[model samples]
Target chain A: MASGSARSCLEEAAALGSAPPVSYEESTMPPVDRSVVADLALFAGLGPAELDEVLREARSIRYPKDSAVFHQGAEADAFFVLLHGHLRVEKTTPQGQQIVVRYVSPGEIFGVAQALALKHYPATAVAAVDSIALCWPSAAWPRLTSKFPSLAANALQTVGSRLQDTQARVIEMSSEQVEQRVAHALLRLANQAGRKIETGVEIDFPISRQDVAEMTGTTLHTVSRILSAWEQRGLVEGGRQRIVLRDPHKLFALAEGRVPSERSGG
Target chain B: MASGSARSCLEEAAALGSAPPVSYEESTMPPVDRSVVADLALFAGLGPAELDEVLREARSIRYPKDSAVFHQGAEADAFFVLLHGHLRVEKTTPQGQQIVVRYVSPGEIFGVAQALALKHYPATAVAAVDSIALCWPSAAWPRLTSKFPSLAANALQTVGSRLQDTQARVIEMSSEQVEQRVAHALLRLANQAGRKIETGVEIDFPISRQDVAEMTGTTLHTVSRILSAWEQRGLVEGGRQRIVLRDPHKLFALAEGRVPSERSGG
Candidate 1:
């Protein structure tokens, strides 16, 4: 189903109608737009000249917070590299339970299904915040690969890392308790999306207790109770939609199958 | 951990300070020995010359039954496209239970972790039977992509389908009964690896009932009992080491959360 939209592109291409548009060098194309390529891991190490080349073939887009970049099962005609803000990858079960699969931050690439041989997206990706991204038509990957070997290597590394993360989630879901899952999820978010303050590491995103509950496969009541208990002991401090980790070591302990000491957050 | 092995390549590339390899048309390079462009759904319409250019850069290999093409935690340096025979992709739990995530057949690709961003294989892939496949060095994808736009489109479609399959499996594991899981697994295996014979369709691989038990998260005793019952009812015929599906429609009904007939296989 993810390929539904992309399929149209193929159908269009096959019927011998509208050929794909090709962009010329920077001098001929739109002004060198380094902002997009600068924030992408794939193009990180490239020189300005190389970045310009990549940008020549890419288009910049702005998405409002909560907008969908790609719906699960839609045709994927292009691959995206996040230039700003965050995106959430999610899937919904037949029972209608939404599982937040993972998050994509600035400098990361999404919609890699474009390079894998599938035409559809396996999950829906929504802008978690106001976002800017660079898009390369799926038609460009092969030409890009042949022209820039680093791009392919970068793509491989991206896919490999994602697979490891997914495998970790599967392992966690299969063996870890919901409490432990919550601890791990929070720790991960802090590591990836956390901002440091005088208090502790604060997750950059505006996640609620309910969001945490859903991520950990538990009810909101359980997450609230657990967080409240932790707050009473000073392990965390949460109020007005903010969470600060008071003790990362203790949280790590909980995530590693150990019993954590009481919270210190007040 | 999938990219752990590939890290060697990365380190080597870094040490050499050599530019990344790109392009599939270097006349100095060997002929296309392996290419997914032809078999891949996304690249279905490329001209013969484009296909040949891809083939020149590909390499083929054979894997014996029970051998692993890649191990979990290993570096993912290449993506594979299976040409013939069956392969089982699985993850091992801390408790040592083997979870057969999926089985792949000819024309399908695996080891795609190389493309996702992580460098490790999240699971192990073993040949369920003697198998032949083509391998594309992870380094080659970038150039291939830029040179042959359709390759990316094909890959994207493939990833989408795989994601859907994995999602379905995850849902079944969470909600389906063991019997239903077993039935579904059997049906899946039959579709991917079964061979039509005069009597019925036989699973192309040499899988034991115990293997099915593990795949279904059930006990061997349970699988044995169920198979015995199915045999008596003529829905299936179980031999010492093989099972033939006599009535796939009935099996499908069982897999769909329905009760099987008392007169089923033996």
Candidate 2:
């Protein structure tokens, strides 16, 4: 190596002292100890001492499938991070219509409303599958934010992103036809938590026809009828709780407002 | 004062070599500033130094009445805080149908699309009237957030609130009737940006009949017909670019999907 490169390497070594080499990926992995604060998105750049302080106050929990992790209007006193498995965010209208807001996968966060205003959960989050999560009480937020400003900033950006998504959804509901809305919802679900199979992508969740209808803001009868039609056309395959896209291109065509009958041959 | 207490105070002061004279207000101002940050719901619990940094970087601008700030799909780079006046957020469908998204007032934010995934503005924001605003560049976001974690956390919370609002709007559009929607929209506008005057609470913005119609996802003709009927009943005073509510309580009754003709009777 050139002398300049060697000098920089020596400086880096001096700065780090003599510690075992750690890769970036390794650092992202959840810490084994319950109280060892891992570098979260909000606290990514914090010093080790500060992280230790956070970790001391952090707790971990495991949630089984179909668990009611939290309910809407409950006092928000903690934030959660999904270490593994899935979480579903949903809301119910006064008319008793259940709407699926979105799904949270690993590395994403839930119960962020605790940090927001109203100090209550705005939506209900359920453990879609057995999940591991990290919890930090709201009391620690002020101290954590003070010690790690970058974390707070990143959190804002994430919230901003969610706001934009919500706005787009509003636009869709106001403007797009129901069929297009359904298409968009399916595309979003696939993007968020789909598993790639040899035939096509499958949304990795035990979603029912009613769940799909609620998500698309359509009737259960309508959803079942449409799915049955698509199944006949070989666009998708559904059996019991599983839904697999056999031909996404055809589904895309339907989403763009083309009649399923017209595209049957294709 | 007790003699022992006075003596102990003097001794402690003398020990510190002439303690600095402190004003109660001045001493508390820092935390008060922190509370103010918290009030913004986008900077809850921000440290004094970080807030000072944000205040230093903020730029103020004035928007003339009815001027378009950012159109949909314009490159997004900054988010704005309304210092004064009102703004109308709207979107146009592919078929050229205009839909009112929301009316923003003082102390609220606009152009938050910069915080989301879009590189472009998602909607059109028009100054409903003469407006003063503070702008924060997206470039400054990273630095501001990194320096002030609470600010970032608050930003996330703000986004969450927006998401919840949008979700509600979607639910309304998907299920509610046009007339009901019009009443709801009017009520929301009155609450958010209307001025309570002797005549009634007039929408504190230069909104047209067409604007109201679009907001409710109805035709201008239909809105005009509805208003004309309401006017004859002495429920409202409708003028070019102005509408005065003669009785807010009665208007609210109408908004609740009730036939309030008797309330507006002679």
Candidate 3:
């Protein structure tokens, strides 16, 4: 972990050993700044003192790039806020298939098993890049939210937003064919993490074709075949772990059924 | 509508027109009983006085069998709890295919647009049977939740539970074959609303092949064909909208991949 000021309240809590959930690697990390999460939707409506109180209960841990934060079926005893960087949340089905549930962006709260009334984490969370997270014991959820009504209100909004996203994905998967679903997934990704390039919006992150396949509920081979077809049509430029949409409108037309599917078959 | 006591506080609120969203049909209906919702999870932490306060804001309406309580794209200005009976919640895709999102039973909440931060209802909610719902204006959500933190806390659990349900469906839809997916869907429905028969458990409410198709993310033709095969194998009995699982364990084995799929060339 990066060096910081001094041993903070989190260290003191770890020494007390009241909760094993939030205690990560021992470090003399500086105390969290109230300003860090002040603007996040999770902390909205909180006063400065209230924010400070919540932050005091948090312990910071640095996750190296591509490291597993938690695994499926592990005891879900903590909740976290991404202080910086991205996380990939995936669920492995009993048949050993992996599905990308969602990617957590910075300022978002996740691993919230308490909200789900679940005793174990349903999916695995991994750091997509080197990341920092502020975590608190799941036991603190009820106490803090009870004392601060706004916390519960904010949590409701967060869970509600995620439910809506999941519903939308379900609808898309149920109603559309494979290529159209993939197109919709890509458009959504661009909307979420796009960077403006000279020609078109390029997805800024280094995301693999396997990630795309997982997101759209298809095999990697199918994704490769579709991307190749799109590349031939000059619709999207696909390289290793990179994708740039050269003609987003055309893809949208195909996805929305305004135009015929260009790929014959895989 | 059923007649009860004289016009009460809800009538007065409707007369004032402060919120038009919950101004249902005028009726001399008796006020809601505190005991009716006192044990409900939503009102779990509330005192009798607080429950009364929340109930006072609700306007009751009786929806006849097969009537719509609300439609997709309608202004989402109200939230509801089922006082009695069941509801079928569905969403139509851009391509006009309908998907059954869920079936809401008595004592459960629905149509809380405030929780989703949505301006309109995302799905159509129809009465699967003659139903009564007590609705509050969406404008009151923040106010009531602010005053009663447990309301927001309970709402979090509700939305989180739905998210997990949706996630489970997404995984099933992505990873499983049609017969297995349909089996899982039926097993879940039976678990939710089944009535014990001599040899099997029957889904108590009337449900159609189309509804099963919608729930399992398959075509109606596919569902019919699969059901016919199951009937022939003595696994289930289907007549009109009724279904009885003659050997639920066999279906469960198929769904969980404990046994090989029996349907061939459907």
Candidate 4:
């Protein structure tokens, strides 16, 4: 991924670290700390022994920023729980168009294709930042789930939220204006990974206009124009693959279809 | 639903047909035969005692066509497994625009907001036709899933498939042409509920052009225009809420973004 300049985006992402591949028994891999995962939603009710059992079959690895943990259509032989940092899940349409499906936060269990009866990954998962994850072989899915029904319940909860979120986006794409959709997308990212700053809440990651376009079913030019207008109005600060909501309440009002307040409160 | 012509669409949907509401303990509700659900994917390997235990907590109820099993934003106190007929899950956006999320076929579980950790249903579920479902109270969710881990696994599988389906639609909506999205939506419906006929496969349900528009994130006018063109081209037969695919293979090709072939095979 670091060296291939000519590779397609997904292909470039696929050639990187995922997890131990029958080669880590001799390596000096540090033991995972239980405290790191005990509070995760996926392991909500899991005890120390349960966490140990779950982690026993897992291997920890770090993926560099912009590298793919798994490419779309690759064999889905493993599932993962992110221990740190962020991830972006992207899907490429059959017609060679790439869409940013969603972003993954830490403590989330992802890439469980076998749970979906899928043999291949449906999307490419890229590390948004340098990220560490504990991955278990797909074969362990049934046994682990059977032994810990809470895992299945938690997974169900996770998938349910995603389905609802995706459907919400579809509704927006269908009925809302492009400006409102972009506003909503920004709000979602901010809600997920916002960091408080003197100006406002920053998305806490590097996200390009192109990524915003893919996420909102709009064009990069349109997103650029909208963001520029918002920037000019001092509603947001944007540049260098970074976005900060300077007036988040105003953005929220815009997202709700309220008229753009010409009276700047800030 | 049968009498209200002035009510909001979602409100109109909220007026009838969920499971027992503290009044059916003495009513003449028929017992749900175990044979009907024994082979369903949900209860894959439950023993007789487990089945009896689950059924004891469930209530079976029939909903008439055009009625709602539950409304969006209602307290999500119960979950359901459809035993007969089709259901349409629809979400009304904050802007009050209705979007058809997906259709539910027999043997599918729906409205498990408790599993998703939501206190209210995010979408309204309507009986696309006369349908029957076995519903369990939300309180039973944790207990039942814990007691029967396979139920949780199966539910995860179901939710996983839905999440994938919704994400696929998002990818299509983000990148595909309206015609392509419409084609994909139709193909999905046909795949899910198509019944083989002498000439071709029929959707086997009353699906209006408005429904198609909602499902594909388009307008009724647009859907009507597109369907009419396909009808004239001898690709499909549409009338009276019935859609028969006269040339499904051709339609499949169209959905896949292939150049529409003018040469008819039939």
Best by DockQ: 4
Better of 1 and 3 by lDDT: 3
The per-model lDDT (C-alpha) reads 0.71, 0.68, 0.83, 0.83
Model 3 regions more than 4 Å off: A1-30, A263-266, B1-30, B263-266
Q: Indicate the worst ten consecutive residues by lDDT in candidate 4 chain B.
A: B4-13
| Model 4 chain A poorest ten-residue lDDT run | A4-13
- Tens digit per residue, CA lDDT, model 4, B92-144: 87767788999999999998899999999998888888888888778898999
What tens-digit string does per-residue lDDT give for candidate 3 at A166-263?
Answer: 99999988888889988988898887777889989898777898999999889999999998988898999998899999999999998897676664
Candidate 1, which segments miss by more than 4 Å at Cα?
A1-32, A56-61, A75-79, A112-121, A135-153, A213-244, A258-266, B1-64, B67-84, B93-97, B107-122, B130-164, B174-183, B197-200, B213-247, B250-266
What is the per-residue lDDT of model 3 for residues B19-117, given as tens digits with 9 covering 90 to 100?
Answer: 555434334343577877778888898888888989877877777777777778878878889888888899988778899999998889999876678
Native contacts, share recovered per candidate:
0.24, 0.64, 0.82, 0.96
**TM-score of candidate 1 versus the correct structure, residues matched by position:** 0.68
Report the first chain's TM-score for all candidates.
0.82, 0.79, 0.86, 0.88
TM-score pick, better of 2 and 3: 3
DockQ of each: 0.19, 0.35, 0.71, 0.74
What docking class should model 1 receive? Answer: incorrect
Question: In model 1, what lDDT does residue B147 have?
Answer: 74
lDDT of 1 by residue, B79-192 (tens): 777888888888887657676667888888677774675477778888877887777677777677667755655565566556556556555655566677778888988887
- Model 2: per-residue lDDT, tens digit, B62-131? 6777776667776776777777788888887665667788888787767766555468787788778887
Among all candidates shown, the one with the greatest TM-score: 3
Sorted on DockQ, best first, the list reads: 4, 3, 2, 1
What's the CA error at residue A68 for candidate 1, in Å? 3.0
